[model samples]
Target: MLTFVAAVSTGFPAQAQNDRATTTVDYTVRVNDTLYDLASYYLTDPGCWTVLKKLNRVADPKHLQPNSTLRIPLALLKQSLLAARAIAVSGSVERTLGQGPFLPLNFDAALTEGDHVRTGPNSFATIQLSDGSHVTLHANTTILIKHLRATVLNGIVDRQFELNQGEVETKVTPLKPQDRYNIISPSVIAGVRGTEFRVVYGDGAGAGNTAVEVLEGKVAAQGPNAPPVLVPQQFGVISDSAGNVGAPIQMLPAPSLAEPGQVQKGLQIVFEIAAMPEARAYRATIATDAGFLHIVNEIRAESPRALFDDMPSGSYFVRLSAIDRNGIEGLSQIYSFRRARPSEASAAATRTANFEFRWTEDAHAGAGAGAQQTYRFVLATNSQLHDPMLDQTALAGTRLVLSDLKPGKYFWSVAAAVSPNNGESHEKPASIRSFTVGQ
Candidate 1:
C-alpha cells in the first residue's frame, strides 16, 4: 500500500503544472503607506520602487491606488536591490551633463530633456543607462545624457551630450554597433566608438570653443559640410562661427623639466593670510623672468589689497610678508601668479576717509591663558609707522572698529602687551599691514 501511494504522487504532472503557474506574491497599498516601504515589504528592496515605476510607466508613486496589480520581475527586483546596496555603501551619484555642479542623487531621481549635469570639484558620478551603457562623469565636468534605450533590433539612440562649460572624460562600453552615442558641444560633434576621451568647453566673447582629446581607441568628428576626421591619441579644437574643425594636434611627451618663475599667463591666483595675534602691516612682491617686479595693484577694502597692476605679460613668482608694531616679520607661503596684458583704466577713481574694522574671539586657540595677549592697533597715513590718527587696544578676539579712513595709502600694525601683575611681558612680536581707501 505505501509503494502504490508513492507511485501515484510521483505521476501527478497536472498538479505540478498548476503549482508552477500559481502566484505567490500580492501587495495592496494602504493610506500613508509610502512606495519605499511597500517595495521593501513585497520586493525585499526599497529601490525596487524605481524599477517598478519605470516598468509600469506610473507617472507618480504618491498617487498609487490602494489596490493595483503590479507584475514584479524576480530578476529585475534582485538586480535593483544589488545596485541600491552598492550605491548605499559607496557615495551617492553626482550627475553632470558636461562640466557643471555636482548634483546629489535623490531617491527616484529621473533625468529629462534640457537638463545640464555637472560634477563638483574632486567628485565624480556613475549612471547605468537603460541600454546597458554606463556613463562615468569625471570631476569638474558637465555632460548631458539626452536619450537612452535598450533594444536588440535597429532602434534609435539619438543622444546629444554637450560640454556646456567644463571638462569631462568619458568611457563608453557599448554592446552593439547599432547603438549610437553622440557628444555635442557648441562647436563640434564627436561620434564615438567604444573608446575613452576627454572634452573641454569654454566661452569667450559670446561664443564657445570645445576641445576633444582622444586617450584610447578612436573617434570620428564631423564638421559642417566637411568630411569626418579620425581622432586617435590626438586633440582638436573647434571655435565659434568657423564651422571648420582644426587638424588633430598630437600631444607632446610630458615635459622633462620646468624653468623657475615660468608661470602660465592669464591664470588667476588667490592668496590668503592666516590670522595673526599682533601683525597689521603686509607687503607683497612679484618677480618675473622678464625682470619685472611690483606690488599688488588692485586694492580692495574688505581684505588685503592687490599690490600691483596686471603683471607685465610674463610668468611670475610672488611672495607676501607682514610686519608688526615691534618690527617683527611674518611671511606667507610662496606662490606663483601670471598676468595678461594690462587693460585700460585698471585703477578706478579713488575715495578718501572710508574704512572699518572689527574684532572677534578666536575659538580654535584656547582663550585666557595664564599670560593673556592684548592687541594694540595703530593706524597712520603713511607707510612709515608715524603720525598715527587712531590707536587702540583690546582683549584677544575683541573686534576693534575703525571707519572714515581717508582715501589714500595707510599703514597699520598691532603689538602684544602683557599685564605686569601676572608677570606677563609686552615685548612679544607685533603685525603690520597697508591698504588704500577708495571713494
Candidate 2:
C-alpha cells in the first residue's frame, strides 16, 4: 500500500533557476576570434563588443581560448541589435530596415536588415556590418546584405555574411578558421579568411577598375581570367574594357596639415611646410609694393614644420620657397599678410645732439604683426643715406635711443625684419622717413 502511494516529482536545480532569472545566451570561443566579431554575430550589433567585454570582464578579446563558454545578457544583446539596425541617413533622417532615399554625395549610411542600399551621383556610404566588418560604397555604388547569421558546426560557431556591391571595405575578425565572409562585385569576387582590407569599384567611365587597400591584414581578390592578387595596401586596377590587370601601386602619403591666416593689420600669415623626398633647405620671401625681402633661410629639419611668432604688421605678399639636395627649388602658393598696429608701441620722437629724431613703431610690420619682426636703427653721418656702416649702432623693440655730441648733421632710419620673432632682423624695407639725428 505504501509503495503504491509513492509519488514522483520533477524540479529544476538551484543554479538552473538562478540562470533563468539572468537570461543569458551561450557562446563558445574559437580560433583566431575576437570578442568584436562574436558580439556582432551573436548580438546582431557591431557595438555590442563594448558591452560584452564589460559584462564578461574581458580585458582583451584577442587571447580568448578556444572552447570557452560565454554568458551574454539577452536584454543587452537585444538593445544593441535594435541600435545597429537603425541607420542615420545624411544627418537629416534615420532609416531602419534600409528603406530610404538614395545616399547623397560624401554622405554616410548604416544598414540593418532589409537594406537595399544604393548610391547617387558622386556619393558614398559606409556600412558597418553585423560581424564587425566595414563596407564603404563608392559613388554610383549598389549593395545589399541579404543574410547574416551565426551557426554551430561541429561544436564551433562561425559568423557568415554575404555582400553584393559596387565597392566595399571589409574588415573581418573571425573567431575560428571556419568563419566565412564573402563579397561579390560585378567582375570580381573577394573572400576573407580573416583580415581587414578595402575594395573600391570605379564609377562612370572608370567602371572596370577595382582598387583595394589593405590596412592591417591580407585579402584575396579574384577575377575572371586573372591570377588572384594578394593585396596588402596593394591595389589592383583591372580594366573592364581590355581585361588587363595592372600592377599594384603603393598609396602616396597624404597631404600635410596647413594653418589658416588671421587678419591683424592687413592679414596675419601662418603656414606649415611639408617634407618632400628631395627637400634639403628652405627659404621664405615677402614682397611689399616697394620691393621683395627675404623672410627665412633655414636648413630642412623635419616635415610638416611650424613657423610662428611675430612679424611686421603690414599688407604684404608672403611666399615659402624650398630647395632640394640637388639645389632644385620649389615655391609654395603665394599668400598675403598685413600687420595692423603695433600692439605695444605707438609713434614717438627722440632728440640726439643738436637735432631731433622722430621714430615710430611699424604697427603693421614686425613681430607684433604676428610674423617675425626685426628692427635695426641706423645712424649715418651723411643725409644722402649712402655708405652706411656695416656694423652700425642699432636698436630693437619699440623704443630707439641715440646719443652723440657730433655737431654735423646725421641721417637715421630703421630696417624691419621678417624672420622668426627671435629678435633678429633679416631684411629691411626702404627707409620710410629720413631725419637728422644731430645738428
lDDT of 1 by residue, 1-439 (tens): 0000011111122442363234222345556656666576555457878877776666777777766755454333321201100011012345533355556654235554455666554344444443323344544556656544322112324344555565554555432433345565555555564555656565211245566666556766555455556665544334343555666655432111112222323333333444344544553444331111112222121234333433444334344444343222232333343344424123211212123332211221222456444567778877677879877766463334453444455666655454455665453333355443322
In candidate 2, what are the lDDT values of residues 193-287, reduced to their tens digit?
55555555553215554444544445544334455555553333343433344444453332222432434332233446555565555544443
Please state the error at residue 23 of candidate 2 in Å. Answer: 34
| Candidate 1 RMSD computed on C-alpha atoms after optimal superposition onto the true structure | 24.3
307 Cα displacement, candidate 1 (Å): 23
Error of 1 at 314 (Å): 37
The best candidate by lDDT is 1
How high is each candidate's TM-score?
0.33, 0.35
Give per-model CA RMSD.
Answer: 24.3, 25.0
